[model samples]
Structures are given as C-alpha cells and as structure tokens.
Target: MSPLVIAGASRGVGLELARLARSGGRPVVALVRPGSDSSELRHLGVEVVAGDALSRADADRLFGSLPAGCDAVSTLSGLAGDGRRADDEGNINLVDAAAASGLTGRFLLITSIGCGEMAPYRSERAIAAFGAAVDAKTRAEEHLRGSGLAWTILRPGGLRTAPATGNGILSADPEMHGFINRADVAQLALRALRDPSTRDQAFAVVDRAEARSVNAIDPHPLLALGA
Candidate 1:
C-alpha cells in the first residue's frame, strides 16, 4: 500500500492516528509545522516532513509529489494558537493539491461536530468560545466536498483524552453530540479509509454510551474494530 500521509501529526488525533497506522505496519508520512518538535513522529518510523499546512506553497509541495494511489488524512486545526486557522486555508490547500495530483485513493478529513448541519446542536457557550474554529472547519469541509477526489469526512464529537473505550461509533444523524476518545476516533478513521462504502459521506462520530442518538449509517465498520 502507498504510505498514508497525515498532516498535523505533531499531536492530538493526528499523532494518535500516526501511531496506529505505524502499529498496523502501514508506511506513514507526517507533515508537521516547521520548528515543532517531531521526535515522537520520527520515533514511529514516520517520514516527518516539516512544513506548515497553512502555507499553500508548502501544502502544494507535499501533495504534489506523493506517489500515485496514496491515501491521505488531515487533522489540521488552528484552535489552540494564534494566527489563521489551518482548519481553513491549510485544509483547502491540501484538498486542492490532492485534486491537482490526480490521486486515485481516498482523502480523509477529520473535522468536528459543531460544523455543518450539527451547528444547532452545539451549546451556546461552546459556540461562544469556539465559534471561529467551527466556522473555519465548516469552510474546510465545504472545500473537500467539492474537490472531486474520493473523500470521506469524519466529524468527531467533543474529543477526550481517555483511552479508547471500544464504544465509539459513527452516526448519520445530523444532531448527534457526545465526547469520544481520540484513540477511538483514530481507529474509526483508519476503518473509514479502508472501507470504500464510507466514501463521499460525512458522519458524526462519538462513543455510543455518550451519544444522544445511535443512527449509524453503517454497522460493519463500527463493529469491525471491536466497537
């Protein structure tokens, strides 16, 4: 299989996904910001490419040279720091570059629940604190949907630092909300990458016990990972 290229692998869901992919014996490459410490990613045997996803030139360089048929995943976000959110321009550039590369494999984007149709379900306070991020991610989601590449968008609910509970699941419902372990989300993402049935679909992901609804569009991938 072509290497799975992951952007924002310096930490959080992206780092966890890189760990899982390497553990599964899949070749991995990580695109992280310049000057960010990438010791962990390098330790995982991932080819660590130091580049800011926020730069269109950097994004283009990374995606343009990928081997044909390579899959990609992006967990880029700008919620924690200053300046423009990679959640918008960064993701858009990546999507555009991927489309330009003529890649035939899937491109998976890991966004969040407050985006798109689930916006109404977010608490007012939460929105007050993160409204800008939500909007940036929403724009990123829109760009990917129109990119023409085979793509899957996983909008994970509130993220948790807890270990994977094996209860995380994907729901087609627009109003689903809950907290899920980042590890579980990573597992689900890998499953989505391998399952062609999930292509061109955006699903809300959360732990079953915490979710308000259980209208999972596909049961197979959820159960495939022992969920």
Candidate 2:
C-alpha cells in the first residue's frame, strides 16, 4: 500500500484521519503549516512537512519532494477569521499540484455542505452566515472536478467533536444537512478511499440520527432562497 498524504493533519478532523490511517498500518505523510501543533501527528509516527496551503511555492516544495509511490491524498484544510478566503485557493493549489504530478491515486477533499448547487438548500440565514466560505469551497470543488484526477468529495455537515455517533451514512441526495462526528467522517473517508464505487462521486454525509432520510430534507426551499 502507498503512503497516504494528509494536508492539515495538525489537529481536528485531519489529525483523527492521520491517526486512523496510521493505526491501519498505512504509511502516513502529513503536510502541516509552519508553527501548528503537530506533536500528536509526530507521535503517531507520521512524516510531517511544513508548508502553507495557499502557497504554490509551498505546494511545489512539498509535492515535488513527496515520497515515491505516493498515490493517495486527503485534505481537511479550511480558513478561519476574515481573510477573503483560503478554502478555494489552498485546496485548489493542492488539487493542481496533484493533477500535475500524474502520480496521485485517489484524492478526497473534506468540504462542507451547502457548497455549489446545494447552497440554496440551507436556510437563508445559514447561507448568509457562511456564504463566503461556502462560495470559496464551491470554487475549490469545481477546480477539483476539472482537475482530471480520480477524486471524491466528502461534504459532511456541521462538524461536532462528540464521540463517534456510530450511524454515519452517505447520501447521494443534495438536500440533506446535519451534523456528523469527526471520527465518523474520517471513517467514511477511509471507506471512500478503498471503495472503487465511490470514485468521481460527491456525497452528502451525515449521521443517520440527524439526517433521518434523504427525503427529510426538502430541496425546494433552496429555490426560493437562491444561491
């Protein structure tokens, strides 16, 4: 098996994914921005590279020297505070690098729900609250879609730090929105990577408890809300 490359493995969902991948006996290489708390990732025996997500130079530096036979890649990076947006630029840089390398196997991106055409399904207030970030991520998703790499985009809703919910499920329906534990999201991502059926598909993932059913979410509301 090839070593899995994880960007933003310093903390949160990225860290959990790295831990899970390592525990499964897969070699793990992590890309962390300089000065982030990567002690846990290092303790997990993950090879860490320091680089900025939005910097093409950093992407070149990291991807150029990536370990041989590197095939799988996952990104859980996003922005905080009010910088116009990093989600689109940062993730696009990675996607571009991966596509240009001609060595990537499966690529998974941990994006949020309500991006792209699904934006209108969210309440106007929710969209307004997170619109900029959502728009940025939508562009990132589009970039990946066109990058010509085998890819899967996992859009999990309202992330929570609670213990594993044990009911995470993937839905093809775009109308659904709810919360999912980070652990469960990582589990699903692992599944997606190994499941050849998931290639090139984008799925809405949520805890079954919260999402209930695909039809539970009404996409019609988005028509009035507008993108």
**What is the lDDT, from 0 to 100, of the residue 145 in candidate 2?**
90
Model 2: per-residue Cα lDDT at residue 94: 86
Candidate number achieving the greatest lDDT relative to the actual structure: 1
lDDT of 1 by residue, 1-227 (tens): 68999998889999999999999889998898888999999999999887887778888888777886999999998844667788898899899988888888899999998788888778889799988888899999999998899999899988998788988888778878788999999999998888767999989898888887545544335436333
* Highest TM-score scorer: 1
Of candidate 2, the 10-residue stretch with the lowest lDDT total is 218-227
**Tens-place lDDT digits, model 2, residues 1-227:** 68888887777778878888889888888888888888898899999998886887887677777654575555544564556356788888888887777755888887888877687687888877887788888898999899988888888888999777667877768788888999888777787777777788888878878884447542211011011
The TM-score between candidate 1 and the true structure equals 0.92
Task: Give candidate 1's total backbone clashes.
Answer: 0
**TM of each candidate vs. truth:** 0.92, 0.89
TM-score of candidate 2 to 2 decimals: 0.89
Instruction: Output the worst ten-in-a-row residue range by lDDT, candidate 1.
Output: 218-227
Clash counts for all predictions: 0, 0
Native RMSD of candidate 1 (Å): 2.4
